[model samples]
Target: MGHTTSTSVSARGRSTVPLLLVALVWSTSAVMASAQAPTSLAPAGWDAGIKLSEARDRNPDPSIVEIDLTARLADVEVAPGKIVKAWTYDGGLPGPLIRAHVGDRVIVHFTNHLPQPTTIHWHGVRVPIEMDGVPDISQPEVKGGDIFTYDFIVRDAGLYWYHPHVMSAAQVGSGLYGALLVEDPADAVGVIDEITLVLSDIGFDSKGVLESADSGGPAGMVFGREGNYILVNGKVMPTLRARSGAPQRWRIVNAAKSRYFLLDLEGQPFYVIGADGGLQERPETTETLLITPGERADVIVTPRGSSGGTLTLRAQLYNRGYGSVEYRNVEDVLTIAFSDQPTLPVQTLPAVHRDIAAPKVAGATRVDVVLTLPPAGADGKSEFRVNGVPFWKAKPYMATVGETQLWTVKNESKFAHPFHLHGFFFLPLDEKLEPIHPMAWKDTLNVPIDGTIRFLVVFDERPGMWMFHCHILDHADGGLMGHVHLGPR
Candidate 1:
């Protein structure tokens, strides 16, 4: 997580709005361009040996169970004999992968080894409010020298993750994050080797020391604090070993604080089997996939036999504001070394389920939400507001229990917002109508630029105040967040 320092809004006056809107449009266009860029090698040498896992079974074979998440500073070897200071979990940048099946109970005895207090928020997991791990909101921050047990039952299964919710901008960028795979037992397991790719960006000097967050102001508020180095599973460049002619399942998550990743596997064809919520209506095959922060993509790639061959995963250059920022591609994210070894029987991917009972919204209540930017100040300082209010602990947004409500999210801001709702998943109902994807059930959804996103959501579970905000870390930190309170049971 990174942030631009906040400044007094009165300083800029009204002149900042046009520039802000232009910046937002520029950022949106940049993402589109980057998504289409070709794959290339990265500047840094790629690192290998990161592990992958399967989420079919709730009980993880002890071989892969129990990941110790401790914060410690270590030297990361980016180039030959060049090591940089990196704050990591379990000794790696993008910590170890934790996999489990839905309904399985998981107990992670987490120890806060960092210099300051921190708490891990399970990004998309549905657990008790007490176990949510939000500092001062759900639970207390885990202090250094203290240990806390994160015990919860996985309810919905798909691609999810965990990161420090306290001082997230600093802690997350310091490399305190990892992947969490929750398996849906009822769904058919897909054929192909399963892999988890935690995508992140790091801004560090030649010595590997990360850059500090920007001082908040107009530039920081609209442009976002971005990094220079792109990483996949903590490696500047990584390669994968696969048998020739093997189908692989890739679970990709955009863990970047502010940058959205447009991933392209040069010439290799793949299908997007799932999204942030879960699987899509059907697998949409394409050469590239775009994922924003707090979003996930479950894709399947079949590597044709090419012995000792390489597959380059490149981040296309995206144009953001007045001009485009180039992602110097050099090192391949991962190379697939094919062997002549006989491949195992391929598993068929699961079919999209459409019969899951969803509550009807026509008979439920409705709520209107407005996502906007605050009035600019004379100092060119800009602020974000949601529903005419900033983030406040006591004044949470609320809705009735057992009610299927229509949430009309109007984006008055120029930039696109990926709004996330905690606890309950929702289905997008078009501009005014609901078209729930066959496999769609997600806690996060992206809103279009200068557009409105309407979703019909049913709040039937236990009532509590859950978080709702843009996935963009800077925007979220700058008071673009609020909580939705479900009526008491």
Candidate 2:
């Protein structure tokens, strides 16, 4: 899904010891007289120079984080003098960052001020059924001027995200998503410099007007609509100041409605340490990181270049289906400008490891899900199907609390689907039906076209209706979606 080419770019030699980057030395006395933000620690605001406005914690207790969230239309300038009224949460594209530590409680007082009804789905978080935010299944959609409350506990530490569940594709593509970071102080990853990146895109016409969600009709929906403009934390081609050889931990989330991200940082290797559910058993290195829609990647990178020079971080062309990359060009996601300081000595990354046991699949219940896309109907409408039937005409797959199911997801269509399951994580299996190496938990995975994906998921004691669908929101809305009942049907 990505280009595989690696080359050395370090301007100096590398060492095995950790080299702490020194603080910036300012010479201007007038600027020094004013208050100076800490330059030693990520220079106050790090990656992309687009600092996400964080949600305010209204509560006084340290263990509980509460914030008021609102979904409405706000004018946002993605580029210089290029402004558009976008659907946003709390008047910002990419919404406010919600941060909390493991075992902390999160309370979100949500209000809907948009023209349509909406609900906030906490993607990848292990919230209870009542807090899952699925309309008609967990709760009804909050209409305009309506309010709702979302309260959940952060059970795992990872990079997760949130967006509207109703009209998901349209809402998300219109830019109504935000990042949620859960931290564990006990995490063995010794790297302290980390930044949460919310990767997404939005479609707008050349005249600075938002494009119609249903722009290309059924065929467009079939191929999945991708924004013409690529974005990083809601900014277009933002700049991140970096010191060559300084390592920075990045927790990245792919929040695009359908687009996939195949990131390449000047062909440098990325030390991947974790996925959807957090740290894996061990770290692995890869030249290009392919993050499908709704997936997350935890990686460590050491920028290497000449001082005062720059490198471009590009999103290589990824072929998700027909015409995906046929005419599309590589997009510049971010610019890494090396600071004036001399390159810090390249240091060996810490030995990061976790002990994640493989899930037992002995006699697990078997479920077959086939994703299909037939020809257009008489009305000239195309519909993607799961198990030969669209969601509206399908029955819910049944399971019980404490039941384990081995799902064989076969994609018979011509496009890839990022399969996602709500409220739980699963272990992907290999051809031998064994857990993949460096076992990590995942709730979303890309099922290649005309291929199959098998995963084992245990329906824990949380009983209710959960959703399973394509993370390509357009496909899901077109019918490639279904429900799983964890209780009596």
Candidate 3:
């Protein structure tokens, strides 16, 4: 369940006042748990199984393992006598948590049990080119009842995720998603009482049935046909028990296809210890956090004097897009019941690494990417073009061996585009004229509406054609996507 928007006014100057008031009200609402009712878990005896595929982790302890992706129909008593179709992994929403060391290898023997073709993309994990799981780009789609194996090395240790890269909007929105945790061996920084939260919004018809796919319709493109149900760890109104005064780490990933989450912890101070790639410069504390789809955050919350009480996790409503669809004061996202126990000792947080800097754009080649919409009467077409040519055009976006390049991405539309590059992470030269977070090493960055984002991107790792595109599923499907080739890098 979500929260309601606040109606308080700030006493500060007009501009800052609205933001402050919103934050205060949002935070207060977020910390207040719902007293209405708890949803029932899926009943036993529902069975669905898929082969566990294999992949590798590149960061901490390099080893190999397997993962399974399958779904089942279950009776979930969300309301009295109500059951819904839940696309899941191992038959459970939120699936099973896949944890590994930094350098371990993950092999996912994925079998498609759904009626359509699907493939899993390990979000944020850098792996072999063939194992990246973008259908047609890396490997063929796993058809219904067909099996495919994905093997890759986990290059970075952080809070990451796995979801369908094929027909992502339909598959992920149906709940074929889960969290992946890669821990650092040497310094077990965030090992205490960790919790994983996969945040997503579900859309259902008046009869509670999920809407079918639309082949490039405006309704599908803009609002993403957002779901009426918001789930955390597969449960509506879920709660985790934590000891009072304990320093708890929450690994939060926004798995929604389009919705952006502005999480407010009800004035309770917490530090953002990690981002999509990994740990940040130091913990930055705040009351509210904004995370778009495909983004991950590892935050630390240290309870104050209020132990043996409940802490609510709520979502604050803001404008849905560039226009006026106000969505303020939503309901709860999750809740935590604190027990009366001594607070655990606070461990020393890792320092942000400045040594591994992004290549400066001064000595790099320049690449211009123009995101274009399909022309009129193109048969319900939504396709992206680079340099005025669709992806099918002959010439590839190629770079010389070991060359650093400046990528200037121009968003021609009014929607925010979270651009993602495969095989490498780049630093945003400027995000809205402000420098990004100090320890920001990212494979995905959100480009604001009608704005340009310049990134000093380097291609020094491998030689292959890699994809770069808006992480928004509908936008990407509609041709707001491209790929780059690293020649003998």
Candidate 4:
């Protein structure tokens, strides 16, 4: 086992703090065994007695793995002396970590116990039409005190997440998300240390209470709700110890409502090997990677030997055309300190998959998803719009199955919006509508604040209803969401 430590980190991104004081109510320890049993904080009604760390992630059963999650209210201490009332699964700030391997069956028995309705939408998974978890689109909302089952084969291996579909503005915005790591059975992670970080930000009022989803009034309405604190795996700027010469794989997920993390390493250079869909073809070594809301990045690095051996994962503060109002300095998300004593062996990686096929363009249809913002209303406030329509009243776009299409996503908003599409990954295109990477697949693409992004997508196999929207949960909740019907019809 290795040593673990934490400290009270300020939101101002100050790196120095008293070491004795740990973050929030959690203590310091290595990635240890599961708790002896469930705590009282577990949802009391159903069989919600499960530990946060014992959520079937390490199960090597090599078959169908089934689990239960009870969605209910719980209190999580985000920082020292700071508690936020949150909607959780099995009573935790970030819900259970769902783990599976490719070709395995994942059966999640979801039970909703909150006062209102909710549904667990697999954020990046291409599941069946009836199991996609979009209320009134793919499936109905799971009402309070109701139970629903999500059984799907782990087809693609990658980093993904799950959160609520109904009331996402409040449910996910407040805190109801978790990581879903689907490993590739043939190409496994190597001996090096691996960490899965669910990066998030939380907002609070002057009264030290958790801010409501609607707290951000007008400007926040147009732009997404921005939080103050940067959290990694539920802790504020926690410190992680890594061996001097070991490589590490950080599977990171940006689970915030609006915060865009322009991550950069202070000590070592990062090799971006995978994305929301899966591994990239060849590793792209870069100093910065932009991870927007609802996006995930699988980066590998060998920390130590640079910057005096003080490895830090910092975000280059990005306002995304929000002006100086939301401007803040760079945030230190996590610290990776070199250790004299070794822990785990360095992990090895297999051949990457970079040759994603391009959509056939000769006979492909051209679809326009032009994001448009309407004029300010009488109240001098503006609501988000997609194709000049909102989700509550928008008409569904129809596409044929087995058809290749060139999608033009023009972001006409004042602020940047990360667009995400369900059911399929698309290949990015250049200004000429030609393939950019020619081999990279992405389910989420960053549409610049007043710029446009093009993609070539092929609707293969599944004939289902899928939602495409701004991944910023608040923006999506504000009606920046739309749907598409894919069928032989």
TM-score of 2: 0.90
lDDT measured at residue 97 in model 1 versus the true structure, 0 to 100: 79
lDDT of 1: 0.65
Model 4 stretches astray by more than 4 angstroms: 1-54, 57-61, 189-191, 205-208, 305-309, 323-326, 341-353
Candidate lDDT scores, in order, read 0.65, 0.83, 0.63, 0.71
Give me the overall lDDT of model 3. Answer: 0.63
Per-candidate TM-scores read 0.79, 0.90, 0.78, 0.83
Cα error, candidate 4, residue 55 (Å): 1.6
Kindly list the per-residue Cα lDDT of model 3 for residues 95-206, writing each as its tens digit: 6678765555676667778877888888877665687778887889988889887777665667788888888888887778888887543223533455677887766665
2 or 4, greater by TM-score? 2
What value does the lDDT take at residue 38 in candidate 1?
31
Q: Alpha-carbon error at 456 in model 2, in Å?
A: 0.9
Which ten residues in a row are the worst by lDDT in model 3? 42-51
Q: Sorted by lDDT, highest first, which candidate order results?
A: 2, 4, 1, 3
Shift in Å, residue 197, candidate 2: 0.6
Give a tens-digit lDDT track for model 4, residues 1-489.
011112211111112222233233112211112322222211122111111243652334555668888899877776677777777788876787887755567888889999898888888886877778888876788998999999887666688899888877678777788888876422233423466888888776645567877875866767777677777776677767656556667788898878889988874577777788776655677878889988889887766543225578899867576752354687898776655454334434333434444566788788888787787789977778888788889988888877788889888877788899987878788898777752456788889878899887778677877889888877787778988889784
lDDT of 1 by residue, 164-242 (tens): 8886766777777888887542232334256688988777887567787663456675655666677777766666766
Q: Whose TM-score is higher: candidate 3's or candidate 4's?
A: 4
Q: After superposition, how far is residue 262 of candidate 2 from its true place, in Å?
A: 0.6
| Best-first order by TM-score | 2, 4, 1, 3
Q: With candidate 1 superimposed using the best TM-score fit, by how many Å does residue 227's alpha carbon deviate from the native?
A: 1.7
lDDT of 1 at 294: 82
